[model samples]
Every structure is written in C-alpha cells, then in structure tokens.
Target chain A: MRAIVWKSATVLILIYVAVMGFLGPVPEREILYETIRNLYFHVPMWFTMTAMFITSLVYSIKYLNTKQESYDVWAVEFANGGILFGFLGLTTGMIWAQFTWGAWWSFDPKQNGAAVTLLIYLAYMVLRNSITDSKSRAKVSAVYNIYAFAAMVPLIFILPRLTDSLHPGAEGNPAFSGYDLDGTMRLVFYPAVIGWIMLGVWIVSLRVRIRNIKDKMYESSL
Target chain B: MKAAYSALAFIALPLFTLAAKYEPVTWDKTFRESGKIFVVVAVVLLILLSVFGYLITQDRRISKIEKELKNK
Candidate 1:
C-alpha cells in the first residue's frame, strides 16, 4: 500500500514539476533568465544522486558490519543508481553551462569536481566487475565503496565551495542567495527534488530485487 | 539657424532618454508570450512519460519472474 502510494506520488509530483517548471515565474536575473528553470531539472539530478550515494554508503557500512550479502547487493545497486543520476546531472549541467557560461567545459572547480566524482564511482563499478569470488568481492568492494563515497563527498561538496566556482553556492558566488530562488521557484524546486529522489530509490529497489533473484537462482542451481 | 538647431537638439534629447532603460539581462519574453514554451513543456513531458512507461514494463516483467520462481 505504501509502495503504491509513494510511487503514485512520485509520478504526480514529477508531472507537476515538468509542467510548472517551464511556466513558473523565475527571478529575471541577468545571466540566468529562462535558464533559471534548469535549476528544477538539473539541480534535482544532483540531489537525487547525492541521496543515492548516501544510501549506498550506509548500506556499505551495514554490509561490512553484518557480512550480509543482501546488504552488499543493496549497496552496489544504490551506487549504480547514484551513477546514473550523477551522469544526468553532469550532462545537464554542461548543457546549462554551455549557454550561460559561454563554454561547455569551463575549468570551473565544481565541474571538475563533478567529473572526478563520476570517475571515482565508475572505478567502483569496475572494481566490482573485476573480482571473481563472491565473498571476497563483497567484502573488498564494500570497503572500496566506503572510500569512493568518502572521496566523492569532498570532491563534490567541499573543494568546490572552498575555491572560486562558476557553479552556485561557491565561496564568492552569491548564487542561490535567499533572493535568487523566489517563492514561486521553490514551489517547483522542492517537489522536483523529492520526485527525482523517489524515482532513484525506485530504480535501485528494482535492481536490488533482480540481483537477489539472480543470486537465489545461482544458489538453487548449485 | 541657431534657434532651429537648439529646438532640434531639445527634441532629440528626450528621444535618446526614451530609447530604453538599461536592462542588465535578456529574457525570452516572446517565447512565453507566443506560448511556444508550452510546446517544449509538452515534449519534455512526453519523454518523461515514455521513461515511466518503460520502467513500468520492466517492473511488470520482474514481478512475473518473481511469481514464476515462487511457483516452482
């Protein structure tokens, strides 16, 4: 019942965001103009990605402490979902930057950090794929996942804030300073974030369930 | 000639001032005015719907597999 409710809510909320995001009133700022709408779409991808990665980190810790295969599966699948959203965020950000910042790949601290973060997560996937033994693979990759996530937090959140960045919320940029996101914009922005995060969770759940079924079949075959 | 020149300059001064206020940014006022932005909204919504549809199908397929495994 709760699954159906939340799933339906996700659908409804996203549809609302899609329709309202384009039409919504935005702060008629100089550079952002219509592109401010990209906040609803682009920013949420990062929010969802961050949420997925955080979930993955928690599951990784759970797996390490409990030595449960299911926990490991949950960790990997959540990380997979995180990477998917992270790519979406990165590409959309690039496209937004192309028009607003006059270049596709500005050497902005945030952009560079986002790229490095994705590469680190990609390495996590590669590391998981390379290992052959199940137990050792789970244990080793869970540890690696912890380190990858730890590295990701600083690369994405910390270093970007410390340096001058083209992206908003940097040390010098008064981006998203209270007046930037007007009440009308936040009406759609918050819903968009929640909806996208819910969708990520849904996708991770599906992947985890499938992996569980596959593992069960393997065990039965033996 | 001097008086005519002064009158012409006085008339042109307000015209220059009326040209436009300095706006720091440009926004697509026409895009919203002509309602063409709705077309973009429709396109985005369609793509979102298709993705949701695909996910639904995948969900159903997985549910079917789960059922089959349970029955066995």
Candidate 2:
C-alpha cells in the first residue's frame, strides 16, 4: 500500500510538472525568455543528481564501517543513477546554452566545473571495475567513492559560486529568484525537484535489488 | 456545447491567472512569441516517455530474474 502510494505520487507529480512546466508563466528576461522553462527540467537534474551522489557518499561510508556488500551495492547503484542524471543535466544544459549563450560549449567556469565533477564520478566507476575480487573491489571503490564525492561537492557547489560563471546564481550572474519574485515558477520547480529525486532513488533501489539477486545467484553457484 | 466551453474556461482559468500574475507584455513575448517552442516541447516529451519506458522494462526484467532465483 505504501509502495503504491509512492509510485502514484511520483508519477502524478512528474506528469503535473511536465504539463505545467511547458505552459507555466515565466519572467521574460532578455536572454532566457521562454527557455527559462528549462529550469524545471535542467536545474532539477543537478539537484537530483547531487542528492543521489550524497546518498552514494553515505552508503560508501557505511560500507567501510559495516563491511556490508549490500551497502556497497547501494553506493554503486546510487552513483550510477547520479551519473545518469549528470549526463542528462549536461545535455539539457548544452541545449539551453546553445540558444542563450550562443554556443554549445562555452568553457564557462560553471560548465567546466560541472564537467570535471562528472569525470570524477566516472573515474569512481572505472576504479570499481579494475578489481576482480568482490571484497577488495567493494572496499577500494567505497574509499574512492568517498574521495570522489568530496571532490565533487567543492567542484559543483563551491567552485561555481567562487568564480564568474555564465550559469545563473554564479559570481557574475543573478539567480532566477531575482526575476521570478512572484514565485509561480516555484510551484512546478519544487515539484520537479522532488519528483526527479524520487525517481532517481527508485531507479537506484531497483538496480541495487538486481545486484543483490545477482550476488545471491553467484553465491549459490559457488 | 455550453458545458464544453465552460470546461475550457475552467482549464484556461488557471493559465489566465498565471498570465495575469506576470505582466501581459512579458508573457506575450516569451510564450506567445514562439510556435517553435512546441517543437522543443515535443522533443522533451519524447525523451521523457522513452526514459520512463526503459525504466519500466528494466524493472520488469529484474523482477522476473528475482522470481526465478527465489524458486530455485
């Protein structure tokens, strides 16, 4: 019953955001114009991704302490979901930038920082695959996951705020809040963030379940 | 016929309220200015649908594998 409600809520919220995001009224700023609607989709991807990465970091730390294989599986799956969200965020950002910033890859500080953060997480995955032994693999990857997440936090959240970034709410740019003072967009924006984070977690949970099943099968075979 | 138009009015009511919340000129320039935006909307819809479909199938496959393992 709880699961049904969760699933229904996730679906309903996403549908509402999708419909309302497109039709929603936005402040017609000079450059953003209609493209500001990308806020609902693009910005939330990063927020969702960041939350997933944080979950990965927690699970990684838990795995180190408890030495539980399930914890490692949870960590890896959350990272996988985060990486997927990162890619979606990057693509949508590029599309938005192409229209607003007049180029696909502008090498802005925020853009560069985002790319590096994604690379750090990608390296964590590659590190996981290098080891053959399951126990060692889990241990090494968990440590690396901790380090990668530490680096990612600074790269995405801190560095962007420190530099003059083309992205909004950066050193040189004003945030969406300045113009969107009416807060109508917040209606859909908050829902979009919640919906995306819920969906990302759902995906990570499914992946972890599959990994657990695979581990069981392997153990039985042995 | 009367009910249908009223239904339309009910739906459009919120949207109009949305428009009125912001300046008319700004709304006109952003939303009404571009028909091409619907193309972008179409693309986004397609991507979202495909993503949801993939997740559903992957979920089903995982559930099937888990069931098989359980029976064994």
Candidate 3:
C-alpha cells in the first residue's frame, strides 16, 4: 500500500513537471526556444548531484562513528550516484552551451571547477580500491570522502565567486531575480528538481539493497 | 557534522529560492555561449564518472578476493 502511494505520488509529480515544461512561459525577444528545454534536464542534474554528495557525506560520517561495513557500503553507493548525476549535468549543460556559445568548450571557472571536483571524488574511489584490508579501506576511504567534500566547497563556491565567468551568478554577472522567472516556469522547474532528487534516492536505495544481498550471499557461502 | 549540515542548508536554501524566483533567459547570445560550455564540461564529466564506476567495481572485486582468502 505504501509502495503504491509512493509510486502514484511520483507519477503525479512527473506529470505536473511535464505539463509545465512543455507549456511554460517564454519572455518576449528570446533567442533559443529549443535550448530552453535543456532546463528540465540540466538543472535537475545539479540537484541530484548535490543531494547524492550530501548522502555520501552523511554515510561517511556514520561510518566514522560506528566503523560499520554497512555504512561504508552506503557511502560508496551514494558517491557513485553523485558522480553519475554530476556527469549528466555536465553533459546537458554542454549541449546547451554548444548551441548558445558557438563552440564546444570554454575555460569558464564553473566548468573547470566542477570538472576538478568530479575528479576528486574519482580519486577517492581509486584510493578505496588500492587498499587490501577491509577496516583500513573503510577508514581511509571515509577520511578521503570527508576531505573531498570539503574540497568541493572551494571549487564550486569560492573560486566561482572570485573569477569572471560566462556562467550566471558569478562576480559581475547579473544575479537571478524573482522578476526574471515567471509563475509558469516555477511550476515545472520546482517539480523537476524534486522528481530528479527522488529518482536519485531510488537509485541509491537499489544499490544499497544489492550490496546487502551480495554480502549475504557471500556470508552464506562461507 | 552538524555545522556542515547547517552550512549547506544555509547556502542552498537561499540559492534555490533565488533560482526559483527568476526564469532562465532563453535564446540569448550569452545563454547560448554558456550552453556550449555546459556541453564540453559534461563530456569530460562523463568520462570521469565512467572512471569512478570502474574503480568502484574493482574495489568490490578486491574485497571479494580478500574475503575468499580469509575463508580459505
């Protein structure tokens, strides 16, 4: 019954998002109507990436507190999900950029910074694999996860603020204001974010369950 | 840990609210330029994600091998 309710809620939310996105408002004298559609895909990717990282950080702290293998598994799974969304976000953003910028790539601060942030997380996973001892693996990986997330702050937040960039919300860039967004756009945009986040959670939940099942099978065989 | 959570909430809430307030300008020259940057970054990000996924699978394999050795 609970599962049905959750599924229905997700369906209804998706429907709402689709309607808003397709029939959303467009300001007069705009240049890229088709490019506007990227919002549904691009913005949600960032939301999912942020949510996944938070989940990973929480589980890392939990592992530190309890030293439990389960917590470590949860952290890794969430981290994996984070990287997936981060990549998707970057891809969609690139598609939008190509049509608008007339080039495939730019040395924008946000672009370079996010790339480095993704690499940090990748390095964390690599560090985990190189260790042979279970306890040592969890301990060192947890420590690295903590540090990587901390490093993300400067890359995503600080550096973007310091330099000029083609991306919005940078220094000297016009900040987003309420007047810029219409009520109709809000209708789709908000729900898109919520739906993507829920989907990310669902993915992480499945990964965690798979990890649990594999562990159980291995233990039984032993 | 609590501090970190609070800080994230503080930063994200305002930014989200601000993002909600404005409609993203579409079809502008600058918007298109930004979009191009987004694509290039995304491709690089995809490659990075694949690498991470590979590393994770390797970690699982190593863990399995270690467990097997202990059992033996």
Candidate 4:
C-alpha cells in the first residue's frame, strides 16, 4: 500500500510539473526567455543523482560494517542508478548551456567538476568488474564507493563554488534562492525535485530487488 | 492525497485566470494565444503517463514473480 502511494505521488507530482513548467509564469529575463523553463527538468537530474549517490554511500557503509551480501547489492544498484542520473544531468546541462551560454562544452568549473565526479564513479564500476571473487569484490567496491562519494561531494559541490562558474550557486549567486528561483518557480521546481527523487528511489529499489532475486536463484542452483 | 486535491484545484483556478493576464515579456505569445501550446503540454503529458504505465506494469510483474518464487 505504501509502495502504491509513493508511485502514485511520483506520477501526480510529475504531471503537475509538466503542466506548470510549460505554461507557468517565469521571470522575464534577457537571454533565458522560454528556456528558463528548462530549470524544471534540468535541475532535478542533479538532485536525483545526488540523492541516489548518498543512498549508495549509506549502503556501502552498512556493507562495510556488516559484510552483508544484501547491503552490497543495495550499494551497487544505488550507485548504478546515480551514475545513470549523473550522465542525464550532464547531457541536459550541456544542451541548456549550448543555448544560453553559447557553447556546447564551456569548460566551466562546474562542468569540469561534474565530469571528474562521474569518472570517479565509473572507476568504481570498473574496479568491481575486475575482481572475480565475490567477497573481495564487495569489500573493495564498498570501500571505493565510500571514497568515490567523498570525492564527489567536494568535486561537484565545493570546488564549483570556489572557482568562478557559469552555473548557479557560486559565492554570491545561490541556487533556489535570491533573484534566480523566485516563489513562483518554487511551486513547480520543488515538486519536480521531489518527484524526480521519488522516481530515482523507486528505480533503485526495483534494481536492488532484482539483484536479490538473482542472488537467490544462484544460491538455489548451487 | 489532500495535497493532490489542492494542487488540482490550483490548476483548475489558473486556467481561467491565465487568459486574463498579460505580461511585458516575449514568451511565445502567439503559440500561447493560439492555444497551440496546450498541444505541446498534451504531448508531454501523454509521454509521462505512458512511462508511468510501463513502470507500474513492471512493478506488478516483479511482484508476481516474487510471489511465485516464495510459493515454490
């Protein structure tokens, strides 16, 4: 029943975001124009990615403490979901940048940081695949996941702020506050973030469950 | 649930008020004026709904498999 409720909430919130994102009033800016509407779709990608990565980090820590196979499954699947969302966020941001910032790849601090963070996560996947034994694979990958998440926070969140960046939320510029995201945009933006996060959690849960089932099948076969 | 109902009510109220208001910005007024923008919204909504349908079906299928495995 709870699962159905969240699934319904995800659908309903996204439906609302889709409707309001297109027709809703936005700040009449000079360069942005209609593309300001991309805020609803673009920003949520990173939010969802970060949420997934954080969940992955938690499970990784849990795996380290308990050495449980299920925790390892949860960690890896959550990381996989995070990686998918991260790439989506990067690509969508590039598209938005091409229109507004006048280049597809602008070598912005935020862009570079995001690329590096994704590379770190990708390396985690490679590390997991290289190991043949299950126990060592889980331990090594769990440790790597923790470090990857640690690197990710500073790379994506902190480093971008230290340097001058075209992306929002720099030293003086703040995201979801000040002049950029006003009260009206919040109506859609907040819902969009929540909706996308819920969807990400749902996907990660499904993947984890499938991984568990696969493990069960393997055990029964053995 | 109550939040969803309130949001629906908010959406319903805005449909009428949206036509009466005008702003000084250049935001594809012609498309909006012609009511063709709703076509775009409709298309997006359709895609979203179909995606939800797929996810829900997948969820149900997985649940069925899990149940069968438990019974076995």
Top of the candidates by DockQ = 1
Q: Select the stronger candidate by TM-score from 2 and 3.
A: 2
Q: For model 4, how does the per-residue alpha-carbon lDDT over A25-44 read when each residue is reduced to its tens digit? A: 88877678888889999999
Go through the candidates in order and give each one's C-alpha lDDT. Answer: 0.89, 0.84, 0.74, 0.89
- DockQ-based ranking: 1, 4, 2, 3
Fnat of candidates, each listed: 0.64, 0.39, 0.07, 0.54
Predicted complex 1: DockQ: 0.49
Expressed as tens digits, the lDDT of each residue in A1-222 for candidate 2 is: 676578668877887888778877776676677778888889899999999999999999999999988899999999999999999999999999999999999998778888998999999899889999989999999999989988987787788888777787774333555564348888899899999999998788888887898789889999
Cα lDDT tens digits for candidate 1, A1-222: 777789889889999999999887777887777888888999999999999999999999999999988999999999999999999999999999999999999989899988999999999999999999989999999999999988997898888999877788875433456767878888999999999999999899989889978987998899
Docking category of candidate 1: acceptable
* CA error at residue A166 for candidate 1, angstroms: 1.3
Q: Where is model 2 more than 4 Å wrong at Cα?
A: A171-176, B1-50
TM-scores of all predicted structures: 0.90, 0.83, 0.72, 0.89
Look at candidate 1 and tell me the lDDT of residue B28. 51
lDDT of 1 at A108: 93
DockQ of each: 0.49, 0.28, 0.05, 0.39
Task: Supply every candidate's count of residue pairs whose N, Cα or C atoms clash at under 3 angstroms.
Answer: 0, 0, 20, 0
Error of 3 at B48 (Å): 25
Segments in model 4 whose C-alpha atoms lie over 4 Å from true places: B1-28
Task: Give the local distance difference test score of model 4.
Answer: 0.89
